[model samples]
Target: MTPPAPSDENLLPAPVLVVEDDPLMRQRLALVLDGLGYAREAITFSQSLGEARAYASNNPLAMALVDLGLPDGNGIELIEELRAQDPSLLILVISAWSTEESILGALRAGATGYVLKERDDLEVSLSIRSVLRGGAPIDPFIARRILALLPVAADHIEPEEPPRPVEAGVLSARESEILELVSQGLTNREIAEQLVISRYTAECHIKRIYRKLAVSSRTRAVNEARQRGLLP
Candidate 1:
């Protein structure tokens, strides 16, 4: 006898909306979402933030895959707008770049997660599912950067106070530029525009900066950067 086939009726597909500007990227993203078993309705694609908003207004989106730079506006701004409309919605930042400032900015703006489009294959899909399930799926390298940024002072097991304020060291010119925009709380897409670089390039730089400074969180990095006279 043949094995029984699965029924679509038994399936619960999550509604997804993907917003990206590049045509090839947009279509490719839809394919990824489809592979995850989401409905075509669940995976609407738009090249601009404006179109995303329009779609969201008409249909309830369970999740969103947003790029940093859209033809009309920054996708981060849409995250804010969508969150305002539906607090329960899951907003994930998907872009080529992952600037230190952009990551922190989106988190502050109420995004539920972040993913790099450069590697949005199986790893990215699993990550999205993980975030939706209450896991904070940080990239391994990102995790290390975050861990470095964590305060050295352990829990109130009363550790000895530092004898001197150790300087975290000044950021190089390129790193400083990245940090300044972070201080302004700009998203990676916005930062990329300000600095004129590809989104992928921006993210790579952030990862490097994190490793160099031995800091994890953007807040810690920015604070330390300021103290070291790295930021103006």
Candidate 2:
């Protein structure tokens, strides 16, 4: 949708816990979430996932924005615990680290979406919105990498008879690969390096993937691909 106007239409006001140590960036995130009608006033800032977990019983956690590196422990664990407790809870991971291992681990931990702190708020906001609306938010290049890592499951993966290409409007095998990596939280540069290509080329491929999938961000692409068994 066009993003809930300036007004709020969300079922729950959505108390989003923002876990970040950086003061400036934290404030910027709070502002962006507010502008997007998520709830800036209800936001709580935590330097570590430990602190966020401490308030679990008291605070109503409708959603959260987590940072990977924290003072106490990796924030991905927090997302995992919270998600397991409440499967409907929304989670978004914001981290500067984009290694294949870290990205994959976070997704496996049940993060509904992932974003790099270095990315613009447009990227962050789009990601959060997509996840909250029942889609996975991921970086495009990362999507491809995850796909490459997908286990070969014949029952899940579509069989190829003469699989030249699905179509211009359809998700190709390569795009499915990229979207899987994105779900795992890989960055464009990392995805390119892993695929042995230039960053620009990787981005162009991601754009095409997005168009074919009709998704605006990484998380949505990943979710769609998974639902279609394209990630496998």
Q: Write the per-residue lDDT of candidate 1 for residues 1-232, one digit (tens) a residue.
A: 1112224522422456788888988777666666655546445678787788887775545677778877786777898788775565677777776766577567656677777777746777776667666766766655565466556523422543332322235345676678778878987678878887644345545644565577887888787777666766
Would you give me the overall lDDT of model 2?
0.72
* Candidate 2: tens digits of C-alpha lDDT, residues 1-232: 2245344443433566888888888987877776677544557788877688886544446678888888888887887788765555678888887887788788777788887888787777788778777889887767776777677433464543331232444655666666777877999889978887555446656766776677898888887777776775
Q: Score every model by TM-score.
A: 0.56, 0.60
State each candidate's clash count: 9, 17
Point out where model 2 deviates above 4 Å: 1-6, 11-13, 151-232
Model 1 alpha-carbon drift over 4 Å, by segment: 1-13, 149-232
**lDDT of residue 139 for candidate 2:** 77
Candidate 1 matches the true fold with a TM-score of: 0.56
Give lDDT per model, in order.
0.66, 0.72
